[model samples]
Target: MFTDGRLLSDPGPILARVRHRGSPRAFVFAGVQRVPVVSEEVGQALKTLAPGDVQLFPVSVEDVDERFFIVNVVRVVDCIDEAGSTGVQHYAEDDPFPERAGEFRWISGLRILPEKTEGARAFMLKRFKHPIIVAEEVKEALERIGNLGVMFKRVTGNPGA
Candidate 1:
């Protein structure tokens, strides 16, 4: 639902079933698709840091009564500095999905115009919702939680470095 950047009317009961038994972290991608899921602690931090940038929906994980929420980052900023970025590829006209010709196929070492973000703390890059971009404050908050299953990459400074 979040991939489209639209507000959900009623997401219904979201269930994240556990496929493997292990200790869960404060944050973790739901599956191979990398859907962002957060524990109550992490969710509270996000709620405080970016109350307007995200919508948290309660989720039920298989066999675990612990509270969790599926993080739906609603903001999609079109601020990618394409020229300053490297290893960026857009779908070409000859590609199978011709409609996506101008859309990002993949991006490595991504860079964005911080000013163009319009002060959004947590957001997804327009046309490339796979990666979530969070401000330093948010990162710090997540780090403070300590048990993160996510990794961070700097996206706004020293492009091409």
Candidate 2:
């Protein structure tokens, strides 16, 4: 999510629009600006499962009666094991956003220092917010709910030599 807590502070009404409607509905999907929109069930589960790691704000989706929420995964941790990762790149000095020159632009074969996660079940990388990292337990819990529009990549297990 791109929100930096400003969304939490803003007291304005929140509205959303679904571009399509079909079966196998996604319980968690990208809303406007890539913000996470989740079903009330998913939202409540997250609130109980990772209360300290996320914040949920109610949202009104066009023509839908079921409650939905915008999930803001609040915790940001600098735990990327850069030395252990592969295909990693940073924003270039000549890029448009020079201030982000040294920040992560892309990362494959992601690895993280488990010890540095601060016991958070869900968190985003300090400089990279594209993926929301969740602990194994959290992953299992979400999986149990089904209809998730996301996938998991193992970044904490042993690397085969």
Top candidate when judged by TM-score against the true structure: 1
List, in order, the clash count of every candidate structure. 0, 0
lDDT of 1: 0.87
TM-score of each: 0.93, 0.88
**Regions of candidate 1 where Cα sits further than 4 Å from its true position:** 159-161
Which window of 10 residues has the lowest lDDT sum in candidate 1? 1-10
Best by lDDT: 1
Point out the worst 10-residue segment of candidate 2 by lDDT.
1-10
Tens digits of per-residue lDDT, candidate 1, 1-161, equal 65566666668898888987898888988777777899999999998999889888999998888999988888889999998788898999999999888899999878999999989999988877678999999999899989899999889779545
Error of 1 at 20 (Å): 2.3
* Per-residue lDDT of candidate 2, residues 1-161 (tens digit): 33552225544578887777754344655655577788888888888878888888888888888888888888888999999988899999999989898899999888899999999887888877778888888788878888888888898766553
**In candidate 2, residue 27 scores what lDDT?**
60
